[model samples]
Target: MRHLCLLVLLAASLAAADPIYVTAFRDPCRAIEVHRLVLANEPVVPLTVVVGGVERQVPAVSVALPRTDWVVHRALVDGLAPATEVTLRFPGTTERVRTLPADLARPLRIATGGDTMHKPEWLAATAKALSARDPDFVVLGGDLAYEDGKNGARVVTWIQTWVASARAPDGRLLPFVSCIGNHEVQGSYGGDITKAPYFYAMLPLGGSATHAIDIGDEVSVILLDSAHTTPIPGPQTAWLAEQLSKRAKRPSIIPIYHYPAWPTVKVSKGEKDPTGNRVSKLIREHWVPLFEAAGVRVVLENDQHTYKRTVPLKGGQPDPGGITYLGDGAWGVDVRRIFPGLTWLAKGAEVRHGYILDIHAGGRIAVTAVDETGKDFDSVDIPAR
Candidate 1:
């Protein structure tokens, strides 16, 4: 079956001289698409891609920032064959992307993390550690750049640093799928989508605050807004219910969003906005039942700078008939202490780490948390239900 994608607004082109970063993903309808964005000074440029020996010149959409020398040229390359190698050439440099196993019958490898901010140095280190895993693609849990999705210069520089540092041991650029977090928007919450210009420019979800992608009929990944730009129980929530209902029979369905439904850090006495309790309450009220009904295998969460795994839970209690929640993102961010002995928690640790998940077609998923030094400190395997 041909891959399906949400239509993207298109404009501009990229050049050979610009620094190129490649990312690949299974689209919303199970097709594999690859994208490359370059930060350059040139205007309206097209580049060439040699895929499995066939070469084609592709157009790019430019996202130009005001008062900056950097112009981001983005190209979405589709109709790709997995398990094969693809190469892109630009005057003095050439980059390569190794595709994942084409057949969904085999194991699929994915790396995930988030909350990368404040320290570009840690971002680099964590990027290297993740790269060593040689992931097919990455899923980030938001908070990409620190404090300013509105600042064009900071956004561009941060993206450049990320692109330059996040590379596999073989030097291939791993593709990433992510949602926006508090850091990606001004005021950190309740901002309109337009407030985060850089995020909208960098990653467009076909004009929606939330979206879902299916991986070869085996797994469905739902990415949510988490009140960053859209409120829960509104349009995004309704859309999520529809999505989950549609994908109910999929072997694995995983949801990723900014705030955790169960946070390991930060208690809320209802004093301020953006507190853990407030965010988690919103999710539990509007989304948890939908998840329970749909049989979502796992939920990936972030915004807390710690690592946590909840016992398979149903309605906030440990139940085998429920969902597993993983995370409290610590990727490149300073670790905060996690109070253990929480009722819903199975494990909790404050560390600088990211998770690698190896999923099989049969529905079993294995997750390993690796530190910045590339050591596996925690591991878990969830057998197929």
Candidate 2:
């Protein structure tokens, strides 16, 4: 995960001497893959990337280097040592550059939900705020941009702004992974994945526009496509079952979508789902069961404006035992209510704000709600291990 730093700082760092940069991620897929864009004025010189004493010369994303902007080149480095520093070096660049450590110890800090983006510095402010504290990575639970599929070109500015937080804290771009939200659907939520052209373009990195990215053997962060491309029961259901089944050993299995299974916020009469609540119904019927069977931790939810955290229950009651579902998304946007009586909620069940989830030395994940004023209002801990 890239820490929060200025792009200019990286450029300046390179100005002194050819700088070797490293971007890191506790990839949901277990191993962390690192990619780099090399820039040098001394013609084209061969470069070799050394990681933890291993040397491999990987190819660039494009043979032709960008004269101005940073170019993206990516590759997966499998079987990596978790909780350890990884480094990257170009021959004779003075010293090697290492990737940053994971944000948490036994667990990791991962904030989620989508559709909470809007306002003047909506994206920028949240990015700056989160960056200030230094988060390992930023995940768009959904609704990254307000663009409603008017045209592929729409949200270009928002895309540019949204991607700033995507950059590594060391100034490298971290992988900004997201699932399909209602706003991402074409025109509205009742559409298919193909209608979200701009989204497909932004996330060309792959995941079927709806796939799961694993964090480690402990956590499986599955991003569902409840929007346009895939449906829950028909095709996606089978895939979701397979993914969950295969990752049964995984301690925590969390899914992020544009819609909500049980919304804390009210739905206006005229409103229809952009991502279909029926999909959540499928998730409730076919998916949540597997989550319980698999010892899943919590599901990162969004779309409805209010704040919510469902009782971690196998059934939707005050069962002393259940999976805690977190989020109704109020990151930057305004919501309708703060929830009535969420007895099952761990915390922030009715707050209108964002939260910072810290994973400690153990697999305990802590949630602290922070308002736009950078104040902490509430906190809770959940065992992610």
Best by lDDT: 1
Q: State the TM-score for model 1.
A: 0.89
Q: Write the per-residue lDDT of candidate 2 for residues 1-385, one digit (tens) a residue.
A: 2444566667554543443323233353334444333333333433455556676665433322212333323445554544444444444443332233433343466655466566536666655555555555556666766676553333544544544443436654333467777676666555665576656544543536566766644555777766456666767777777888898776556677767666665544454532234556666787777777777766778877667766676766666456777777766666665555545555544434665666554345677666555566766677754
Candidate 1 Cα errors over 4 Å, as ranges: 1-17, 24-40, 270-276
How much is the lDDT of residue 83 in candidate 2?
47
lDDT of 1 by residue, 1-385 (tens): 1222222211222322345665443462223333334435455566677876889977767776545556666666666665667787654457777666644666787888889766878877777888898877788888887746666766665676677777878887666778879888877778877777777766755556577877667787788988888888788888999999898788788889988888887877753432347768899999999988887768899988998888999987888867888898898898997755577888888888889888888688899988888898988887776
Candidate number achieving the greatest TM-score relative to the actual structure:
1
User: Least lDDT summed over 10 consecutive residues: which range in candidate 1?
Assistant: 4-13
The deviation in Å at residue 164 for candidate 1 is 2.5
In candidate 1, the residue pairs with backbone N, CA or C atoms under 3 Å apart (3 or more residues apart, or in different chains) clash, namely 11-61, 12-60, 23-175
For each candidate in turn, the TM-score is: 0.89, 0.71
